[model samples]
Structures are given as C-alpha cells and as structure tokens.
Target: MSKVKKRIRPTKEQAQELNRRLDAVVEAGHTSNLYCDCDVCQALAEQAKLMGYRTDVTIKRPSDKWDRRKREYERRRQNDAVKMASLAGQGLTSAEIGGKMHRSKSYINKLAKEFEITLATKKRGRKLCH
Candidate 1:
C-alpha cells in the first residue's frame, strides 16, 4: 500500500487572515496591490503553495483583462458555492447553481466537481513512487 501525503491544516488565525484577504479582493472586484509581509501572510503563501494551491501575493493589484473583470462581477455565487462545496455534504451541481447565478453551466459544473475532489473527506489515492 502507498501513502497519502498529509495536508497541513492552517491555524485558525491564519484562516481568518486569508479570509480577510480574499474578502478584500472579492469586495473590490480587484486584487490587492500590496503584499502583506506579515508572518501569517507568508506562512499562508507557503502552505497554500505546498498544498498545490496556485496563489499570488498581491505586491501590486494587477489590472484584470475584460473577461476577468466581468467574472469578478459574477463571482458572488461561485464564491458561495466554493464555500459550500468545501463542506462535507452531498454537494450541489453546476447547472443548478448556474441557473441561479446566470453563469455558464459547464464551467460551474466543472468547478463543483473539482471542489468536491479537492475538499474531499476521503484521502487521496496513492500512486507508486517510481
């Protein structure tokens, strides 16, 4: 049998701060322009990356392309689903949520499924380390 690498769960304080950063970005429909050099911020950056989360620290708020900007306006529902999907449940479908949000059905469905895997309660399947 192979082993699944254990993911490091963030500290409560860390989660709070990361939540703050995310809320700030979403509320403004823009990324932050400054990187918070606080120790908690750095730890989050490292841990999220280590866990295969692709994230960018806001050293400067980068301007978004047109589509990106449009999506930002539409992000509220997706963001809500993101939180919901992260919870342990039967989970919702993209098309169901999409109709409510007026988003592309395919995209939302894909996200719902992906989030299910990533936030899965089950352990990851292991592969042979050749």
Candidate 2:
C-alpha cells in the first residue's frame, strides 16, 4: 500500500501574522522592482517560515524587447569558444565535439568559423589526425 502524506497548517494567530508580513513584503517589492530570489527577499522568506508561514513567491523587473535581446546576447557570450577551438585543434571533428559537449554540429561549425579554426571533414565514423 502507498503511504499518504499529512499537511501541517498554521494556527489562526500565526496565519494572521504571516499574512501581515507577506503583504508588507509584496507592497515593498511592487514599488522597488525587487526580485524574490535576491538575498533580502530570501531573508524575508526565511522570516516567514520562522513565523509559521510557508509561501512561494516570484518577482521580476519590467523590461522591453531591446533589454531582453541584450540580456540574451550577454548570456550567450559566456560560452567558451576558445576552448571549443582548442578542442577542434586537437583533431576532433565538429560532430565529435558536438557529441562530447552536447551541442549541435552546426553550432560547432559556427563557433569554428567565428574563431577561425579549420575543421577536417571526413567519412562517417572515421576521425582525422591533426
């Protein structure tokens, strides 16, 4: 037989206190663009737990399309193209590197071209020597 789980609920007074604190936190966050995952918000979450409240919260800053595009590009820029090129220099084909790195062969080719690394194309299942 499968075991059933029990739920723990807060008492009335604890619930009231938790609600008051949560409202204040939400109100402050709305005006300040405060994200829930930040350190201050996380501390507020811990405080809520200590006060007998369990809550899940999420908050985000507003941004336009340009801001979103810039953030995406910055995130993509963190990839290790230099390391990819170094791996290619060690006689690994784009497909092999893609397999090892969990990336597509086309992405490997793009990185190779962007970094000026020459990849040797050979027959399937055959590796080229540098």
Candidate 3:
C-alpha cells in the first residue's frame, strides 16, 4: 500500500505576505526577473511550485542582433536561389553548377527543387564506337 502525502497549506499571514511580495515585484517591473536566483524570487517560485503551479516564467524580448543576422542570412539565401535559377536558365548541368558554386550536385538539385527551377538532364559519357 502506498502512503498518501498530506499537502501543507499556507497560513493566512503567509498568503498575504506572498501576495504583497508578488505585487511589489510586478509594480517594480521585475516580472521578467522572476526566474532570478534571489532569495525572495526563489521562495516565491518554490511556493508556487508546491501549489501545483509553474515556477519558471520566461518573458521573451526581441534581440536586434539576432534579428539582423537572421535577415542577412535570409537575404543571402534568396540571392543564392536567384543565382542558381539564372545558372540553370543558362543550360548548365547540375554538376557544372555545383562546381561553379562550390556546392554538391545534391545541393544544386535541392535548390532547384526549392526554387521551382527546372534543371537540364542529359547523359554525359564517352561516345560509343559503331
């Protein structure tokens, strides 16, 4: 038989103190700092966790450096796709395009498929003697 654990409820004074601290933290614009390792924050987190609540709260803020880097990467990828499309339009085979772009034939094929650019498929080998 498993023994059941009794949940200890907080007293009225403790509940009021917790509410006051929470309000103060919120009014001080420290909600984002709730995940801090400070004594008060840790105590509050522990209490909330014991109450069957989530203690880890995250507030997401936009990062300008990350956003700028992402945009730059996207721009470079778009430009590469355009270049690949133009190269395909010039009747270059996948292997030739891969060599020129310093990429693999599979990469060229994937890019062609992604950009909806049709690539030429031709047989390349030594000519057979009759």
What is the number of backbone collisions in each predicted candidate, taken in the order shown?
1, 0, 0
Better of 1 and 2 by TM-score: 2
TM-score of candidate 2 versus the correct structure, residues matched by position: 0.38
Model 2 has an lDDT value of 0.69
Ranking by TM-score: 3, 2, 1
lDDT of 2 by residue, 1-130 (tens): 8985444676788677666766776776743654456655665666665654444444445658868999887566446576677777788888988888888989888877876778767767857787
Candidate 1: where is the Cα deviation over 4 Å? 31-47, 50-130
**Candidate 3, residue 3: lDDT:** 93
The candidate maximizing lDDT is 3
Q: Rank the candidates by lDDT, best first.
A: 3, 2, 1
The TM-scores, one per candidate, come to: 0.26, 0.38, 0.48
Give residue 91's lDDT in candidate 1 (0 to 100).
47
Clash pairs of candidate 2? Answer: none
Better of 1 and 3 by lDDT: 3
Per-candidate RMSD, Å? 20.1, 12.1, 11.3
lDDT of 3 by residue, 73-129 (tens): 889768878888889889998988888888889988887888888988787899999
Q: In model 3, where is the ten-residue run with the lowest total lDDT?
A: 52-61
Q: List runs of model 2 lying over 4 Å from the truth.
A: 1-78, 123-130
User: How well is each residue in 1-130 modelled by candidate 1, as lDDT tens digits?
Assistant: 8996666776787677667766655565544534455554555566556444645543344466866878985696568666556442444445545555576766665666755533233336997899
